[model samples]
Target: MGAAPFPAGILIAAVVFHATVVLSSFPATFHLERGITANYKLKLSKLKERDRVRHGRMLQSSGVGVVDFPVQGTFDPFLVGLYYTRLQLGTPPRDFYVQIDTGSDVLWVSCGSCNGCPVNSGLHIPLNFFDPGSSPTASLISCSDQRCSLGLQSSDSVCSAQNNLCGYNFQYGDGSGTSGYYVSDLLHFDTVLGGSVMNNSSAPIVFGCSALQTGDLTKSDRAVDGIFGFGQQDMSVVSQLASQGISPRAFSHCLKGDDSGGGILVLGEIVEPNIVYTPLVPSQPHYNLNMQSISVNGQTLAIDPSVFGTSSSQGTIIDSGTTLAYLAEAAYDPFISAITSIVSPSVRPYLSKGNHCYLISSRVVLRCGALAFRKFRVKG
Candidate 1:
């Protein structure tokens, strides 16, 4: 049938090939700053690339992670009000919601009935973020600006009677989400190089203006506006940094809660302490090498055929968007048993037929060789 089992010799060869590919790729797991804007073409291509990794019997989910997004500024005490994974463009900062999605690129927000768009809402939707006089010399994204096309696609906007573009839409994520647009006259922040409020007066911050709607929507921010798309896309906030000569491929994030104080996000390199970091090799530009084989508790079980089938070769990806490790059915038993033993036995694991490979206890410890997955607990 399927190419006649590849003959014994060929099958052995395939096994060797499998090991070689992963093993060889292991050494390539570090970020290289190869000059900003220079490697952007390379980054964009990988995001759009179609070939997916298939391992043994499992096909890795075709999800891309956009881990770098600006911490939302909330009208309420920011550190307290900001609970959503994503931020909307139009809703009040304290009430916005966004998905920490790794599946698609582009960060978008929902702007209900927006028009005359610009920054966040793109072009079609409109949002009001300006003084009619437009005395702010900092608003640089004009109808004839090249950045609009470079970051955002283009607008189908015609002039309103006042001869102004009206408002704009900032579309970052996919159809799964939307963000209206607003123009931050400038993007300002405390300098990383020097401790001063550095201002990019000419730079316009275009965001996905969104509204927090109902039904399975992110629960943290019901009164929020929209999400911040951190996925890899040409129009992402990370991608917009090309002007400052920053690399889009090299980025990181740390989400801190009420108790832990906080964490830091390193865009180029990780300079933090005490974090057991896993070095990943970027296969091309934006994509990293996935793992195909796993050994738990010193025992190797037959990988689930459901993962890829006996003949496939894609591997497991370490996703920041996903909070848990996804294992095939073959790998589930030992995976759970090992975790249960280390974590509180009160924790319970779940298997949802064809749905989840296994719903791991909310937080649990997972030990693999020298690497340990801590903060392990179970949610009901």
Candidate 2:
């Protein structure tokens, strides 16, 4: 797929935290770092592997109250593509490194009794498990809880007959899955004050304690402790904090593209005057956007508007977990044709393993600019 124009920063909601909060108070922001260190080819290959599985499936508050997390990982899609941050959980605060994904809703970690959880990681990070027995503040969520009811409706959660625990079994499109129960504990983070001073803070959060893993999740090649989803659901960490009035109900992120990968993930809205806004498809399970048309080098492609429409199984979704962009089958041909038509005469375009490959010489100058998308409204 051709490269699309990306905003300097992304804001999920319109209300900026700074404008909403009082002058005496500030909202908390979570800072995240990229964690991948794999080579370019390996990362690209992993992206393809993840894309194959993912195409199948598919915050906040306040205070002079800014929560920031120190992130680790690269932002370059060709290099280390996945970004993760450290979370201190439980009573005594055990550290867990989780991938920051905007595609799913729950925040889960490998538990002490987890079967098939990786003991070590190829990413060079020490793997740790969340042992509920070790944390004094940890408690298992029951099936009767309201959160569990919501989980049952929105996710793969079910009530276990034995002990009446809220158990979840998440199956990905790639055949990988995880089964576990819900656990509530304190999530530790750093609260920034006066834009310079930092203070430690903690909040009660509901998260998964994975007891079993299968498929790619069991592999140590690119493993992490768990996944921290920045989704728009009650079970997500962002919404949990927002319901508690800890921060605004929005989040923003800016991924740095340099080799030394690090970026900012704010639990609150980012105040940017130059940011463009697009309406999200309402009440959808994923972050679906209404894309009306595609433009290549100021020329619009002759693709149907319905190609990007929201339906039960079709829509344009923005997912952070996915490193590569995927076009719908209906728009693929037109997009490729437009891209190829604009290429220089010296450059050669070929097909390799079902992928559109381009061979351009060092001497050739390709003046390709932004691939723009026009957003249109869709009636619910």
Q: Pick the candidate with the highest TM-score.
A: 2
Give residue 252's lDDT in candidate 1 (0 to 100): 57
Lowest lDDT block of 10, candidate 1: 51-60
Give per-residue lDDT, candidate 1, residue 118: 27
lDDT, candidate 2, 262-308, per-residue tens: 67776766554577889999999899998999788998888888788
lDDT of 1 by residue, 246-289 (tens): 33354555555333223334233343357675545444222344
For each candidate, how many residue pairs have backbone atoms clashing (under 3 Å)?
A: 71, 26
CA RMSD (A), model 1: 19.2
lDDT on C-alpha atoms for all candidate structures: 0.36, 0.73
TM-scores, all candidates, are 0.44, 0.75
